[model samples]
Target: MVLKIALIGAGLIGREHAKLISSNPRVQLEAVADISEAGKVLADEYGTRYFFDVREMLDATKPDGVIIALPNAFHAEAAMACIERGIPSLVEKPVADTLEAAMQLTEAVERKGVPVLVGHQRRHSPDIAKARQLMNEGALGRLVAVNAMWLTDKPTNYFDAAWRRQPGGGPLLINLIHDIDCLRFICGEIESVMAFSSNEVRSFEVEDTASISVKFTNGALGTLLMSDTAVSPYNWDTAAGQALYFPHQPENTYVFAGTKASLALPLMDFWRHENENSHWQHPLLRQHITLDGSRAYENQLHHFLDVIEGKAEPIVSVRDGMLTLATILAITKAGKEGRIINVADMLG
Candidate 1:
């Protein structure tokens, strides 16, 4: 049976969701809600209803599930509407624009016991899921240190939106938040962060580059470098060949070093000595980790279907998304203040 799904927003990602929902046999695009005519056009294309307000769409269409792809600030409001109607929803990443907003929505969902999945779609990628499985199985064996990168170049007009020139719209939240979420997913909770940021290239008040130091609650440490004004394909979106829009560039963007061995992601190369208990002086051997050969977005939609059916739980819940947002916020605060910021303190 095809489940009817509605979408909020008609922007880039909202369009992507429309296409994805249309393509899935298990789901149908029931309606679209946006304040723009684009929403009407998209609904016409998909043979679905259109509404200027998400609440009106929800009340009229009463979809089995909703996908909120609106701007960050509207995420909570849209998802709350879904929860109010006792409908499950997939709220696109960051969960909300502010930590408080996220908590508010999270509290409502928890109280009502209405399932709302936070869209950190990368977590659904085969490689990311495999990494977490490997870590859990002690394949990495006591995570020690890690390194990651997300350097890329965006066209000048990409920042034409005024918000992109401001702090919240920069790569830290716009791009690097994925990396931060992946790190937290693969490694563990981020305890604190210290960073150095600059806006020299774009100089639009938002940082164009940053270097981050991370300390995990589990005692693992990691480093990350990010930029949207640089020319490089060392980011997971490209390197993993899993992202929807980017051309595939096979490379390793993250490396996890542990007491027993080391692992490089997207490449899935596991490195360790010929002997398990060998010292660093010994030569290292390489092995590849096998994956299920699935795509991220598709898997995410399938999982959302499962969540709506009460057959699965959300992998990235709202509270969990808050932690990721808080961690990134900590990095932002750290860079701005020139001091270490604790992730937990950000919630208080």
Candidate 2:
């Protein structure tokens, strides 16, 4: 059975989600809502219903599932409305602007007993999946440390969208959250975090560069580095050179160091490691696991459809969203305060 979908927000990410949903035979894009006329244009292009208000869309075309891809600040409000109506929803990344908002939305979803999935599409990437599998299978035995880096060349078009420059929508929430959530998926829970950021070289109010360090509950340490000021491309370099097939904007890289072995992957390189008898000469198996065939957005849409069909568990629940958002908020707070912040404290 094809699951009907209602998409909220007509921005780049929302349109990407809509394209994926519409193309899937198991899913149908039924409606779209955005406050801008661009929403109507997208709806017309896709031959789906369009609305200027979310409430009006909900009233007019009641879809089986909704994908909320609005601005970060609008996530909680939009998600709460859908949950109140008992409609399963897939909210885009970061979930909300603040930890308090994330918690409230999570509570609303729990109270309504509706499935709420956050759109952390990295979890659906095939290369990431393999890495996760390897981690689970002890390929990286007793992980020791993880280092992640994502540097991008921000074109003028990035600033073309006024909201992208605002306080709540900078590199941390907009881009780095993917890495943070993916790290959690592979490395385990983060106990505490310290972050430093700067707005240098970018014509925005929010920081364009950020460095974060995490203390995992598993006793593993992690360092995450992100910058939008990178004049030269990084994702593409990783995708082409490392042959790590990432879906879109292929510019992130990761290096995982384990007690038994260590491996470095650019973007989404999912390779196994060969353990040596001696600890000094640990060698990594040079098998490049490519997942360029499937787009993360498409996989995420299918997962949402499965949730609506009652055939699978949500890949990213509202609870997961809360936790990830809380972690990011903690990092950002720490960066601002120049102190380490406990992830547990942000949960409250």
Candidate 3:
């Protein structure tokens, strides 16, 4: 059966979702709602109906499932509308603009018993999924420490949007949140964070660079360096070649160092002693973990369809998305306050 899927917002990520819907054989692009000229153009291009008002579109189409790709501020409201009408939706990440908003949406979703998937897309990637599974199975062993880097140079005009220069729109929330969520998913909850951020490079209200330290509840530690002003391809988007719009750079962007061995992602290299009794003096062996040549966005679309059909639950639920948001928010706060911040405090 070809399920019908509607899209709210036709912006960058929304456009990508539209393309996915158009190509997937299991779903039809029911309609699109966007308050922009680009939205209409996109709808016309895809040969789908277009609406300026969200409710009007929802009422007119009554799609089996919806994809909420609206801006950060509108995510909760858009998802709530779907929930009220008993429609399942895939909300683009961050879940909502603020903690309060996320909490409200979570309550509404739970009360309505409607399934809502958070678009972290990385969770759907086979390598990341396998990494989490292996970690759970102690493949990395003891999960001691992790190091990650997301360094890339964004075109100066990328900040032409006012929000991109403000606090909520920086790389911390916009980019590193994925890494944080991946970490949480692979390891465990983050207990506390200490960070330092700088906007000196761009001199914008939002930071262009940040260094963060986190302690995981499982006694593991992590360090992450992020900079939008740097020129490099050390980010997962390019390294893993899974991002829709990024050119594949093919490098290891994340490293998980455990007591028994260390794993580097995107490269999928596992390094440890040749045998169980070997120590640090022994030569290490590198084994490549093979992955299915599947794509993240495609897998995510199939998962959403399964969610709509009650065949599966969301891999990244609304609450889980909110927690990831809280952790990043804590990092942002820690960066600004120059202190160690507890992730739990962000909830309060």
Top model number, TM-score:
3
User: 1-348, model 2: which lDDT tens digit per residue?
Assistant: 777889999987787777777668888889989999989999999998889989889878888989998988899899888887888889888889888888888788777778888988878877677678878988778899999887877777868878789888888888888888988998888999998989878757888898899999999999988888885455422442422233344544778888755555544444444535554445456655555666566677778888887888788888898888888888889989999999999876
Report how far residue 63 has shifted in candidate 1, in Å. 0.5
**Clash totals for all candidate models:** 0, 2, 0
Of candidates 3 and 1, the better by TM-score: 3
Largest lDDT belongs to which candidate?
A: 3
Q: Which ranking of candidates, highest TM-score first? A: 3, 1, 2
Q: Candidate 1: how many backbone clashes?
A: 0
Alpha-carbon lDDT of model 3:
0.93
Residue 185, candidate 1: C-alpha displacement in angstroms: 1.0
Q: In candidate 1, what are the lDDT values of residues 1-348, reduced to their tens digit?
A: 899999998988899999899889999999899999999999999988899977888998889999998877788988999999999999998798889898898899899999999999999999999888889999878999999999999998877767778856778988899999999999989999999999888778889999999999999989999999789989999999998888999999999999888999999999998877789788899999888889999999999999999999999999999999999999999999999999989999
**Alpha-carbon error at 38 in model 1, in Å?**
1.7
Residues 1-348 of candidate 3: C-alpha lDDT, one tens digit per residue:
999999999988999999999889999999999999988999999999999999999999999999998768889999999998999999998899899999999888888899999999999998899899889899778999999999999998888777778867888888999999999999989999999999999899889999999999999999999999899989999999899999999999999999889999988999988779999888999999999989999999999999999999999999999999999999999998999999998998
Assess each prediction's global lDDT (C-alpha) against the native. Answer: 0.91, 0.80, 0.93
Evaluation by lDDT, superior candidate among 1 and 2: 1
- Can you tell me which runs of candidate 1 are displaced by over 4 Å? none
TM-score for each model: 0.98, 0.91, 0.99
